[model samples]
Target: MAWTRLLPVADLPVGMARTVRVGLDDVLVCRLDDQRVHVLEDVCSHDDAPLGDQEIEGGCVTCPRHGARFDIESGAVRRSPAPVGIATYPARIQDSWVEADLED
Candidate 1:
């Protein structure tokens, strides 16, 4: 796994997510709080729709298109309309920047 710097910690607002390009894939970088952050694939598991500009609560992100809730950390399915779980990456804050361990 290769760690890539996506953005600054200050750039990601708490309780929100930002989409970043990792190689040819779009990943969602979510900041749960000042100390916790998670990364997931940008697509919804239920449908082929993008997951962003949505609401996050209780460590899950609600898919805007179908309202499927997915756990940001473990990529677990938290709601219906999603037959599977999303893919999650290892994320951490390094030198005031958000870094994710993604495939290289």
Candidate 2:
């Protein structure tokens, strides 16, 4: 797997999310806390709504359109209306930058 640098770790505030384009994919990168970060697809599974602007609470992102909530870390379905979970990517911090494996 190849790790692609998205942005600086310091640029991403804790408990917030940002969208980055890697190749042809629009990835949503969320910083859950000081030490944890999650990368997932930017679209909601059920209605294909964009999740980039959704609010994150309790480690889950609630879809603004239909009220579907999904866990940021594991891409699990936390609340219905989503029906299924989205795709998650492996993320890490290296050289003070946030990186994610886009090969998967």
Location of the lowest summed lDDT over 10 successive residues in candidate 1: 47-56
Off by over 4 Å in 2: none
- lDDT of model number 1: 0.88
* Candidate 1 wrong stretches, greater than 4 Å: none
TM per candidate comes to 0.92, 0.92
List of clashing residue pairs for candidate 2: none
Candidate 1's residue-wise lDDT over 1-104, tens digit each? 67899999998889988888867888899999999889899999887788976557888888889889998989999998999998988889999999998863
Candidate that would win on lDDT: 1
Prediction 2 TM-score vs. true: 0.92
Q: Local distance difference test, per candidate? A: 0.88, 0.87
RMSD of 2: 1.2
Clashing pairs in 1: none
